[model samples]
Target: MSEQADLKRTPLWDAHRRLGARMVPFGGWDMPVQYATGILAEAKAVRTTAGLFDVSHMGRLEVHGPTAREALESLTPNVIGKLALKKGHYTLFLNERGGVIDDLIVYCQEPNLYKLIVNASNTEKDCAWIQSHLPAGSVLTNRTPDTALLALQGPLAVTIMAAAGAPEASEIRRFERVAVRLFNNPAWAMRTGYTGEDGFEIQCSATSAENLWNALLRVAGPNLVPCGLGARDVLRIEAAYPLYGHEIDDDCNPWEAGLGWVLKKTEGFIGAEALARLKESQARQLVGLTMETRSVARQGATVLAGDRPCGEVVSGTFSPNVNASIALAYVDRDVTDETLTVESGGRRQNAARTPLPFVDLPVARKKKPAGLTSTASL
Candidate 1:
């Protein structure tokens, strides 16, 4: 079999090929890494107007039963007790030692139904972990093979979505979702995305993905272009969004990843004791680094504090939005707020510890329209 045949393909594989995308293997799946326009162009398009991403490879799973919420709470850091119906929260699945298994987005789609969007590579592991910890009456279903995921991101995404038969797009607020009809098909439209922009993630059937994609293309026209994983990585890094296996992984805990806020000590959950201890001990910390030069520091690059090794770069990329070389790394808490040197491509570049989200979104906390209230129904 050809190398390409050995890799799994999403439903939009033909669409990406038709658009002349540069296909690559990502998380064991044949995915488009970029288009002919390049990552730089794709990033700019999303920041300025809108961009469409075929993220169908991401894992989608369902947890249902009377004890679903309790089961999920036992596995993730987010307080599931506080989640309202149809509301979503960003959470992390942690190991017994307080290390992150995967960062995920969980949505309480209904009173007893919960939906989880996990990293593509860790789908099986995440599902197994949840099932193993689930209560006796709870049930877990992996729907990744049947679901299609798409992200429409940018300042103008709402306009494009509204025009493409998603009139209720104007009613969904951030971290909220609604069951809506698109192109005469049912879809779960959520006001959330990886890019630090106003956007929506549309989930539907694999059979309906192509039709909706084409319809979105027709409506977005020149303003929205099809992007791929390469651009997604750069844009997410610019926004300071953590990536699984990069900014966080099985060996990294929430305290060291700058995600301590998500852990509510009062709420008894898995890894609570270990997390509390880590917070009190103050061992390591996650910090952002900006390079003095344009030479990018890549993952696994050695980070030096003066003459000694201090840490390793986890996620590093050439940020198209900031026009700088940026990275996220873990360093000793005491070593934070200090200057360091990074070895990239056999050259040493000066770097300094900076705050998370090197590039801030101007209106991250802006209020949505009145019609976008949480209680609004489609």
Candidate 2:
């Protein structure tokens, strides 16, 4: 690991290689894009059963002080004022113009302590931004190198967690965290995931991560397939979850990205003034689109309303679960029910405005033990 290679390798690098994973460079790290089972199969496995992901490549940081929440509020959009201890939330770091710098999950470890999980590529920039805006009493520490993240997702994810002796696992609600013992080691398990399924994101010490990973695989056996970024991308797209650089970026604000709901207008925070202005202007809107033909619309594709170009596609993919080509794009708000056209592969195809989550699953209705209410929320 060179100090200036613009790339970092996670602790599970060797383990992924041993598992015959196809290694690729992501955010300067050697990451597994997929395994021998391939992306389509892995996506199907997660939609049906469970899929395990090695997200150790992501970044983790700790903020400790009496004014931790206040300091964070100055940098992100989520209302940290009401966040209870041991709870976590999805938030975004905004620039002065209300543009998104990055999306992150903030964990309220204690009244005065917070843990921030961020995208791998934005670790340095995010840390610098947070540190620069911290109050006099606040302290920020980078813990990415010492922590490991593992996500177990799917309909049967809870079953695997319960079988692993995670008594509190069944009780953790969505977006909630609980300190539990897994494989006889201490771990912070959060009932949350990106696959839009019932699952948990377990954070543990780097030293014991491999042990827990192996134990999970053993417990899951054939049901839990080890998925990689390829499937993760597809699954998130299917669920209409936004991706950092694609769906949003430093050039796009929350309202333009279909994330205005995350902003609390009452709580004055950084970029609030600019966001209010953008809301008043409201020139564009984010929407989901389904192609009328079999052709797939990809990122950067041109979205046309009649003969005029209205907007551009952001994140898109051929939905394996829906068996159709779907895409998400930023279009003119005037484009309401009108049939539009998407230019892809040197051809234009008919597309229709549609609701998100092209494929909906009713897995949440399934019954589990009473103590598992916490996991259900995740």
TM-score to native of every candidate shown: 0.94, 0.92
Candidate 2 lDDT over 150-250, as tens digits, reads 99999888889888888668778788989988878899899888888889999999999888988999988999999999999988888888888888899
Off by over 4 Å in 2: 1-6, 361-378
- For model 1, how does the per-residue alpha-carbon lDDT over 1-378 read when each residue is reduced to its tens digit? 487788888889998999999999888799999999999999889999999999998999999999998888888877897988899998988887888999999999888899999999999899889988999888999998897999999988988987888876976878898888887789989999998888999998998888888888887899898999999999888888889889888878877787887785444677877786776775777778999998888899988888788888988888888888899887777785468999867889899787778777733666678677655542
- In model 1, the worst 10-residue window by lDDT is 369-378
- In angstroms, give how far residue 333 of model 1 lies from its true place: 1.1
User: Residue 168 CA error for candidate 1 (Å)?
Assistant: 2.6
Model 1 residue-pair collision total = 0
